[model samples]
Target chain A: MKKFLAITLVLALVVLGVAAKVKPIKLGAVLPLGDITGRQAANAMKLAVKEINAAGGVLGRPLELIIVDDEMNPSKGAAAIDKLATIDKVDFFIGGMSSGVHLAQIPILKKYQKITVWIGAASHLCEKALAGADWYFHLHPWDYQQGAGYAIGWKQILEKYPQVKFDRVFLAYEEGAFGTASYKAYLAMLEQAKQGEGPYVGLVKEFKGESFKSAAFGGGDYRAVLRLAKEWNPDAFIWAGYDADALPMMAQAKEIGFAPPIFIGAPPGWPADFGKSPLSEGVVLYGMWAPSLNKVSPVAEHFYNAYVKEFGEEPATYFAPLGYTNVYFLVEGIKKAGTLEKEALIKALEQVEYESPLGETLKIAPSAVIKHQGFTTQKILQWQNGKQEVIWPFEVQTAEFIYPFPKWEGR
Target chain B: MKKLGMLIILAVVALGFLFPLYAGPYPLHVMTTVLTYMALGLSWDMMLRTGQLSFGTAGFFGLGSYAALLTTLYLGLNPLASIFVGGVFAAIVAFALGYAILRLREIYFAITTLALAGVFTVVARNLHDFTGGPEGKILPSAIFNGDPTKVYWLTFSVALGSILVSELFQRTRIRFAITAIRNDEITAKSSGIDIFKYLLFVFVITSAIQGVVGGAYAQQYGFVSPESAFSTNFLLLPIAMCLAGGIYSTLGPVIGSVILGVLSEYLKLRFPYGHLIIYGVIIVAIVLFMPHGILGMLKKIAQKTRTEVGGNENEK
Candidate 1:
């Protein structure tokens, strides 16, 4: 009887030990959950974790995601990093949206030196602050990269549609960090164009920029800048501001009858009902991914359907797909590494070619400052029939280019 | 009773000094943030004791941030010395502005000081070459190389210094003059109190404290943007904490900072999505019901208890 009992007790202890060894891999995400971009990104991350767990997780261990809200305050954002690292003891770190918040978090992230895959913070200053930390993988294009991508997209468009003209470009930017940075990027591009050395060479001949206070920052008046742009009479007119300026800027543009050949709104995200507005027709914009990509990419389609069914709302921001990719990409790295060891995992992550829903195979490459940069380009799209139609990157073209922004006289 | 109270105060201070030894990085980080706000709250209340409502906390804080960062970047000054420069610059600016704005009383002065932050932000943004434009500037590394314990001690020392200044104001002749001015400025002037001198002195001192705190914050985070450094949160949150702790006394702002700061973090952890709403409701409820604040309520209870016991003793 004693011999039988001893064998049974040892078996029970072994089973318990194995169960303990199969602990879930924790991913800490710090984001501004109050914002739509952060909100949707978090939701998509949760969905990805759920699906991965349902599929028996990575290496037969479940994945756990712990999210903390940064409140968009720098101090709060830094504290969230500390909580995620020390308190939660998360294995990896992910999620980011604002450049300012990420700037504060960079120090703390460096302290922990955890493997991180961030999906936001497009500011080039963040790139400089990061200072080539190998453990960090940034998936968003830097501000300069985005600017070059726009020049490239325009070049492609001019080639594809000989009828379209964009020699002179006028930029109306908001007087904030984001808008100011965009203006600076354009100025640099113009300098490059003059030297005939960069992507903007032979693309932009005359570029003029004026700054305006965005409505989001309590200054809604865009008439001054718009009137200036109208006076310049550029072939392409673009405004770098917030979503709050989208409809009002359009309405005010129509009021002043200032319609250029290409009317572009380059806000980070648009109003949910923007596409429903009649003024949105033929308005060019730039983004990483759009809902129309669902038709071309089965992965995007599956993500869209599953997300809508799960959350009961459409994923309005590209952050949703990027956030989903943030998880799956890391899981793939883990699978390739076969263990969660830091050196091995970093090496494995360096080689991951994630077929992302962003309509691109995400491969890491050396950027200006960092070693692992993903998605160096954004897409050029236009609002047509209440839908954002991909017009550039011909392989993922959802619709043809809609040139000569329609006159405001008609419906 | 006095000795026991003294013992308690000493014990608390000692514990705070030793906190980093026992606690982890997260709590230390949270406490450091709380200390920053606590110092700001104390400084704000100090200025209020002069019967003047000054909304210049954020302005001076931002000015200090920029001053420290610029000195460090351009002059290659030591980080610690740059913080002193930040305070001195804020005091100089405040002393000059105080001469003009201090003449205006009540809401006019408040409104003018409130515009200081906006004016400073515009200047910082437009001076693209020096201030890095709107994108701001960053340090190569954080202060103390991102050491949580060292960072916490630095912030704790700042808060303690503010507390000492506040205590000095409470315990000295400056308190009587400020009290007289707050009670009736005309009467104070007639009594040979030199109201302008007292008000200017308090303003400069408080502004200096704010600048010092801001400089430390900039160094700790290793960056400063016009938007982040000059954020209205620096003004609004400290004011809220002072109100919640009770106004006028040094202990009020300290107690308020501890309670509201920790409660905010706790609520965030407990309910991430709905925490802000809940935190707002709690603050509103506290301000509405406890008008004088948690400290005031506790003092009232202590006073009533003593009165009840004294009445019973007299009857016996």
Candidate 2:
């Protein structure tokens, strides 16, 4: 009995040792899984992973996902990437929701020299790689492109509000790199447009002493900030921020009677399915491609159908498309690279030019912006009645822009 | 006896300093955050020493982080200078607020501090002029420049410095006055101890320490949002660590931080959202089973053993 037991123990030890040596394809998912954006990104990624594994997996080896929670924090996001790279021994990383989180992980990703496929970082600066980081690949549309789309919509609103002829546009953005860059782009564009346009001055206000560099709300109530805006009496309020902030700010602005003719917001809160917040209607939101609306491409139908069949909900927001496009393109890159090896994967990713569910074929760029395709730009959507409708980039117009907010008379 | 204790502590400190070098990335990150909590816990105890319970450590922490983040982002200040500036800002704010609120005793003091933290959070969220509001701020890469190992070293050094400062305060006449105040504030005041001055001094100094640690933490983590900085987790964990380690003593916070910090990491990994429950259970059990704390229990055991040995020697 002792001899048999010893043999069994030896067999178990050998099996355990062999199991440890069997290296699986390690793919890391760095997400804000506990928060709203993270939850959506994680769920979408899980769905993609499930579909991939079912479809014979990547490189004949089952793909394993090691998700690290960024907790919607930039430092945590970087730390999550560090853990994924050093501890999990992942081959590559894919995920990000909050722009702050993405910007935080950029330097770390650069240091580690890992191929990171950004799922939802709208910051054009991160996409540009001012520091010249090549390993970082952004799958989502750049906010600058979205800002331009917003400018197009703003052009119409400005024309509509010609009678209101006012100066000073208040720019309130999140203090991260993404928000700062977007704000700069928006400000520059507005400045050029508002040039010599009669008392049309601009007052860029952030909190006292601290500039809008580090995502501080600048140290006062949104109502107080709005009151300051009321004091300034800007022609409009151009807020480039995510859902977590925009909803409450709008509520507070309404409370304090700072109703501008236009209130424009960015991705996180601008989705048509922003069901959680009561301030869902009337605010003009700019987001990346929503699978439900961006059905111009044939791939959208297949993706939309598959997503609905699997998840039991329509793909109303960009979460599904972002996840689907990232995984689909990543897998395509893996296939093109011809191996699951890191260098091969990166090489393949660089060579990628595949049609995504969002209708555009994503091409990897030699420049910092990894995905170089025409569709890798943002679109403007407005919350009319109860749902978001694509209004800008007139070519793909699902709906027309509702001119003048609050007392908006025309659609 | 002091020399022996110092030498033993030196060895432990060296180990604490060196472990990050050999540890895996995950463990190193956990240890870094542990050091952050250790600094927070010690500072909290220092304030409590003056018989003032502050619920605004998170507020000061949030403010310090913003100060560091803002300086680094806009002014392009050096990392060390940013941390110092953040600490100074927090200390000044604490000094002003402590003067106004320190007159109230016990729960009022606690509630007032809690209200102060809420005000800071509200300001952080809505102001949108300085802070990013709900989106939070992204710290610049210039601080430690994305080197996790270097950041770990920074945290260790800061934690050590905070501990030494706390020890110095403990051994001072100020500490004796604080003790007298905690035991009997009226008597402490009657004995020529200006209660308000000491209270404000302790509050400001402790807030400065928390701010420094908070600044270091913000840079180390590379992001600061109102929610993450002012989260109840930050406030609760440090208090739990100080109380569990045996509050009012230097060793208690240090030891408590080590245990709870490690346990919090493990629980977070295993249970994710459910770990808070496990954390509450462990804390409740510890508070119930050993009211004086593990260290105090160990001292009692040692004294009893020594007494038994002396009696045995007499019998022999």
What are the Cα lDDT values of the candidates? 0.94, 0.71
**Runs of candidate 2 exceeding 4 Å displacement:** A1-22, A123-130, A153-186, A195-267, A270-284, A289-291, A294-298, A308-317, A339-347, A364-376, A382-411, B1-8, B62-78, B81-140, B218-236, B272-316
TM (chain A), candidate 1: 0.96
TM-score of each: 0.98, 0.75
| Listed models, DockQ each | 0.84, 0.24
- Index of the highest-lDDT prediction: 1
Look at candidate 2 and tell me the lDDT of residue A411. Answer: 19
lDDT (tens digit, per residue) of candidate 2 on A1-411:
999999999999998888686666677987765554555556666677788889877776567777776766555566677778887889888877776567667767777776678776665545543245555677665655554545455455456445532244567755544455555665555565467331222322221111232223343245555676667666566665554465566667767766676666653544334545556556777666654464466676777777778767766557667776766677788878878667677777788787776545677654334444224456667776676676655555666565556641221
Q: State in Å the error of residue B70, model 1.
A: 1.6
Worst 10 residues of 1 chain B by lDDT: B68-77
| Model 2: docking quality category | acceptable
Query: What are the C-alpha RMSDs, in order, of all predicted structures?
Result: 1.8, 7.3
Model 1 Cα lDDT, one tens digit per residue, A241-290: 99999999999999999999999999999999999999999999999999
